[model samples]
Target: WDGVSPDRNFTGIENYTQLFTRPELFRVFFVSFYYLAASAVQIVIALYFATVLSFDLRLRNLFKGILFFPYLINGVAIGFVFLYFFQDGGTLDSILSWFGVGGDHAWLGDPESANTSLAGVSVWRFTGLNFVLFLGAIQSIPGELYEAAQLDGASRWQQFRHIIAPSIKPVVSLSVILAISGSLAVFEIPYIMTGGATDTSTFVIQTVKLAFQFNKTGLASACAVVLLLIILLVTWIQRRIVPDDKVDLV
Candidate 1:
């Protein structure tokens, strides 16, 4: 859409068709799937932590601040932190070395480990967001609900299974949708870590590569359009599954 004047033809589906035909697309799609899956795992872990923290516990503010610190920092900075940790002579590698388990390895550089390494960064950086979302949902639940459940002789786990699970379904669904969309568009972290390596390149990264590196604006536009549709479809499905309360409120 930039610097094209009126000279270029609008090829419509041709560009989109090329997205499937292109070889580089494999890495793009894989990276997107990897990101989404890793993000889901992170969100689940955060929600669990949030649930625990929701109890009347000491040092709650301290715990919350620690959990959210990563998100407050630059994602690229966090990526570099993980990069150093994954690199040889870094903290994690030193820990591994101490255990007599494994030696120094460039986790972000290797093909097999690159995606995992970046996914770990993505997960850690955004875990705070999921934690807050879950915490909000947890606090919104009525105290009377828990009291009534206790009167019914409900155990903590059972109360969580019945009350918390049902009450937070919408929040869970929304988080899942957001994670999928946001992770699919991953760029900065991977770019900073591995420069869109084939094993870790995401759709958004490939879109930039296609447009700038290969001068394939048509294909890049197509990829972007496809990504948008995928996000919209997922969002629509989430809304359908979790029924928008806005309509009810209206």
Candidate 2:
């Protein structure tokens, strides 16, 4: 369907063929790489904070809430909020100005920085959920294990390596799968913020534009199918790499 015609035509594999042939397809996937990198950073940040807060700390609960607050907000709202924050002479600019950095830089307008800036927003918003996951997994470890490790004069790093790391292996694997899938399907933030401008269009955003904006429903459907296949492939590879095994936290 051309999205406007009453007649339905069969174009078996033509849509998929065109999809694969398009140069824009490469660009869109390349855009996804930025978010993929950001997701890795986000997971690390979350794990760090989760590990720190899992231990005794001043105002730990407060810090947890603060970190998780961004995840609680609606994605569209977060996108809009960051729009002004990234605009010239905006909140971010003012903050940078305090550090002797010029405020004239276009964080979202420049092609070079737009994707990175949007990826940063994604990292900030999603890190909290990963944090909660890591924190819970860490806290579930038996306190006696930490006590035993301490008795042997095990350093903090050693304890994490031998105990905390093994205990949270399942959660870590889950987070990685989620991050990779999320990175590939990223849409809301870039869509709402840049409307896919400045070379920031992601695969999902492109599919959406094809379906609604361009009235190419068939092509859009093909794109969606390809995305699903890509996600499944990635998930399968992840499961193979991190097979489910009983982790002894003791």
Candidate 3:
């Protein structure tokens, strides 16, 4: 955790070269699929609720508070809570049993399900932030546009497609950026819930393990740098694809 240790001293470039030669390096990317899945789910949920439910201020506030509450809770605590929820005969299993499924299934114990469970938790926790962002974007659309659309006998779906979506293109782009970066950097939930076990290990968790657990700070630094570059590269690519909305002042 500190640069002061003599044993942790090593060249990051060399560490990078050495680390990539190992076969387990690809496992990091494999586990990172969870992030991709969670981000997509979050975006869809955020948009749906923002568009369909934003008009009901009282109900919207209630739902927002409930959904956003998870984000307010400490990451470590969230991990613990979900860990118990997914444990054998725990809340999740109880609910599943009600639906006549998940009989004797160990959600976190199974390599196949562990990362997925973590990803679902990620969506549950972070979707609320995006919901608010989309909600604000929706609210900012001028009432006149909706009124005009209404006069034209435009359906709600058409109004959303033509007016709401175009007006909030910038916010959507911003949400995509945040979602991708946040997903790539995910660490705490997986760390506390699974301890990088059962193939639920992520890039950030691996970096932490290399640094603190193995005292390979240089290699860990290399991993951190690689992850940072991946995020930057992906963000750059996203921006290129969905350039920011430009306003004409002239």
> lDDT tens digits, residues 1-250, model 1?
4335567877768876777777767446766767787888888899888888988899998999999888899877877777678777688888987889676777766766888778878888889999999999989888888889899999989988988877787788888888978977888888876777647777888889888887777778888888899889988987887784521111
TM-score of each candidate structure, all chains considered together:
0.89, 0.97, 0.91
Candidate that scores best on TM-score: 2
RMSD of 2: 1.2
Show pairs that collide, candidate 1: none
Q: What residue runs in model 3 are displaced by over 4 Å at the alpha carbon?
A: 1-4, 7-12, 56-58, 247-250
Clashes of 3: 0
Query: Candidate 2: worst 10 consecutive residues by lDDT?
Result: 241-250
Between 2 and 3, whose lDDT is larger?
2
lDDT of 3 by residue, 1-250 (tens): 2556555444536777877888696468777777887899999998988898766556767786786677788889899999999888899889988888857678899887888899999998998888888988888777888889899999989998888888888898998888888877889999999998998888888888887888777777878888889889999999999999753212
Q: What are the Cα lDDT values of the candidates?
A: 0.80, 0.92, 0.83
After superposition, which runs of candidate 1 have C-alpha atoms over 4 Å from their true positions? 1-6, 241-250
User: In terms of lDDT, which candidate is stronger, 1 or 2?
Assistant: 2
Q: Give me the candidate number with maximum lDDT.
A: 2
Error of 3 at 218 (Å): 0.6
